[model samples]
Target: MGLAGLRIVLVEPAGPINVGSIARAMKNFGLQQLVLVNPQCDRLSVEALRMAVHAKEILESAVIVATLPEALQGCVRAVATTARVRDWEAPLENPRTALPWLIEQPTQPAALIFGREDRGLSNEELNYAQRFIRIPTSESYASLNLATAVAICCYELAQYAESPEIQTPQETELAPLELVESYYQQLESLLLNIGYLYPHTAASRMEKFRQIYNRTHLQTKEVTMLLGILRQVEWALKTPRKDEKL
Candidate 1:
């Protein structure tokens, strides 16, 4: 369930031809799930259908959502593809090394997110993915078409699926994006209340924290522990207990 379990997420795709070609590539690699975030063109138009050919079902069945987070709701793992340099500390990884991390959890859903045809994914949009991958191209001509990037990543995913080492022992089950998001929201509110984060600069500061946690590959119990600490902070803020520092 490598490519099969991964959703090909396109954020604000403006071209029907690109979307249709991506759908066709997905079908070629045995990938069925496709999610579109705020698409700018008609995914079901005659243009899309013409490019999809025999893979028209993938185009027809694509899930259309309003935001990147909504596209990744239940997914436990996600890898975002980009050609630009990121402000975050995490190093950009190659597709072969990064993609297997997505399909490793057979029971859990995962995602491979691609950005817009023109501008690509913004920093905020990229925060939704735990891992980041960039395809190596000639420095003189580094631009890659939206569908071309998806085709490359989809091929890598298909290769991972066919390999015999698809399964491996795990330390713990990876936490879901929704669960991590809940922690982020609560943590942000608590930090703001304590004055650790200012209202104006909190968003940027919190992204640093997100980068730290995303690299940790946190498990379910770990998130629960951190949330427990936040909950204790919440309790202390309300009761103002004598032993604890507010």
Candidate 2:
């Protein structure tokens, strides 16, 4: 169902073997979309192709982008897998619980993001995702291989693909990520102008604002309303008050 619309996004994957294995896992679970963001290794390398096996087509047709935002261009929903915990308000869920949410509806495109092999997603990259997933592992050896992580998540995603209970359609059309992102840029500028955020601290402060708005799942009109408010604020700040002329 929604598997068709799901995109597996790997950010800066450094190992061709891992990238190839991930492609195979995706194909095994009926996923067709693979997005590689600034990959450090060649997806078509001999090692990569060897691991991909019958899934070479997945590698051949994979979409390569320069950045995470570009990878998520038209996606309405995104979930990022992380290994580190931060002070943010977003909850870190496991694969089964969160993976299903990605494919809840088949109509719109969604994304599941994985980070670099050496280090997981940074806080800035994590901000682009509305949901976060952290796989549970043993206390002794907590780290997971990049390819292994993708396989585990893919298996869970495939399980949910056959289940009809979670297929309830979304009520409203959520705003495209591009629209939401534009609002963030506008809001940040407005905040800077009003001194709510300083030049050095804008990025961190905006992460909080992102978390707040992301939780609301704002629709297109809702985002438009917010943009209008920001525009009015910008205008109000530029125009002198009636008494200021004196």
Q: In TM-score terms, which candidate is top? A: 2
lDDT of each: 0.89, 0.91
lDDT of 1 by residue, 1-246 (tens): 556778999999999999999999999999999999999999999999999999999998999999988999888898988889877687899999999888776678899999988888888878878889999999899999999999998898888888886565563578989899999999999999999999999988988999999999888889999999999989977896687786
The global Cα lDDT (0 to 1) of model 2 is: 0.91
Q: What TM-score should be assigned to candidate 1?
A: 0.94
The reply for model 2, stretches above 4 Å from the true place, is none
TM-score of every model versus the real structure: 0.94, 0.97
Clashes of 2: 0
Best by lDDT: 2
The residue-level lDDT of candidate 2 at 95 comes to 87
The sequence of per-residue lDDT tens digits that candidate 2 reaches over residues 18-47 is 999998999898999999999899999999
Q: State in Å the error of residue 69, model 2.
A: 0.6
